[model samples]
Target: MKIEIWSDVMCPFCYIGKNNFEQALEKLPFKNEVEIEWKSFQLDPTLDASKPQSTIEYFKEKKGFPAEQASQMIAQVAQMGKGAGIDFNFEKALVINTFAAHKLLHLAKKHGKSSEMEEALFKAHFTDGKNVGDVEELISLAEKTGIDNDEARRALTSDEFNYEINQDIQEAKNNGISSVPFFVLNGKYAVSGAQPAEVFADALQQTYKETASPFKDLSQNGGASCDTDGCSI
Candidate 1:
């Protein structure tokens, strides 16, 4: 089965959802038959890449949230991250445009390393506090994911994967997906948000059953058959 995940690198819940979803898959019997495709989504595409800011400051100035409220929200998300085994340091996280990073993700997808690239970007933004919009930083992260440095740099420096990124975004919009961390299981069922592992496991099993092959041959002994030789018993 194929699972397409729509997520943003800077979204805390996306990272948490990824971990939880993987945990769910680990308990499944047909885990090896699963294929994951990471789709691109930007929470704030209008964010200026040149001016990086802390999450608190971004919330305060851009989103019009007061300092106290922003801090509280961050605290809540951090606690949730802890439950998912993610050490989210929002204090150091810089909110920057992830368009370039998304392009790099397309490049990674071409090389079958999209999962690795997505994980790296999430950790860089939520844990390591790196500027994901920066070309050099993106190249470095891609390199760690086994993507060639020059190829990564070319992808970032040029507009090669912009169409793929935009297509993913457009597809999400058409599908009425207004949130990150949305999971499409086998293109049959949808699971939204950072749901529990049990939820994912159940969805997987249910989708598998629904989509599994229906034919089953039951033959205990050989029967009479006719071939080029005319007849057999």
Candidate 2:
């Protein structure tokens, strides 16, 4: 089965949904057979890459919530992350443009470490409060994730993966996706929002049965995929 997820790195719910979806995958019997793709979606396209703001202030301004309410909201999200075995430090987070980060993600995908790089970027931005929009910082992150610094720099400066990211965003718009953490299963099933692990698990299993169970014969199709019919013999 193939699962395509459209999300933004700066979006808190995107990371939350990531953790939840990962847990759900772990519970599935065909976890190893599942192919997952992370598509780019920017929440702040107009954000200046040169100067990023602090997470708390950004949240306050965006939500029009008071400081106390914003803090409580962060606390609530942190509590939820704790349950998913993640440590989120919303106090130290940076609110920046995620377009470059998404570009690097496609580069990482070429190196077969897209998911690892994504997790590292999320932690660096949300927990360590690193400036994700900075090229040097991003290069450092890529190097830490086993990608070469030169490759990272090249990707940062080049327009190589920018088109891919834009394509994802455009496709999401075409699919009527107005939110982050949108999951599309086998192009036939879609689940939105940062749902609980159980919810994701249910979606995965249900989609799996809907797509995989009926096509148990693998010899004819050899596991190759189709858009709507899935892999069929």
Candidate 3:
């Protein structure tokens, strides 16, 4: 079974959803058979990476939210994150383009370190307040996640994984996904937003049951010779 999660490092709910889904995985009986793939997403693709701005300012200036309202909003998200074991420092989270981070994620995916890379990126952005768009910082994060530093450097230096990153985004669009923290279970079950762990667990259990071996094809006959209502003789 495959569970693909579309998320952006800048999304507070994405982090919470990740935590919830991981927790859900822990209680799942078929967890070992399930593979979790983290897909790339960018909250603000047009933002200039060179100009660093705090997340608070981004919400205030970019979104045109009042200071008090923005602070309250961040506080609400922070409280939710704390409940899910995340320490979100929205006050200092630097707002920058995540395209490079997403690119590095694809490299990590090749190494089977995509989840690790996602964790490192989220920690760097939400907790340590690092600029995620910087290549040097991304290389360091990749290294921390067990990706070779030199290889990571090369992948970042060149325009690598840009297509994969865009493809993930396009896939999301094709799937009618208009937001981050969207999860697709077995390519059939769609769970949106940062739902509770129980919700995730339920979705997993349901999908597993629906696709379980009990429903396997056991016919001796091939039953594979028909096309356009014409049987292959």
Is 1 or 2 the stronger prediction by lDDT? 1
Worst 10 residues of 2 by lDDT: 215-224
Select the stronger candidate by TM-score from 2 and 3.
3
lDDT score for residue 223 of model 1: 85
Against the unseen true structure, what C-alpha lDDT does each candidate score? 0.92, 0.88, 0.89
Q: Model 3: runs farther than 4 Å from truth?
A: 214-233
What's the lDDT for residue 115 in model 3? 88
Q: TM-score for each prediction?
A: 0.91, 0.88, 0.91
For residues 1-233, write the lDDT of model 1, one tens digit per residue: 99999999889999999999999999999999999999999999999988999999999999999999999999999999999899999999999999998998899999998888888998999999999999999989988888889998999999899889999999999999999899999887899999988999999998887778644558888688999969998
Per-candidate Cα RMSD to the true structure, in Å, reads 3.9, 6.4, 5.1
Model 3, TM vs. native: 0.91
Candidate 2 residue-wise lDDT, 25-105, digit = tens: 998889998988999999989888998887678878876888888888889989888887778988788888888898789
TM-score, structure 2 vs. true: 0.88
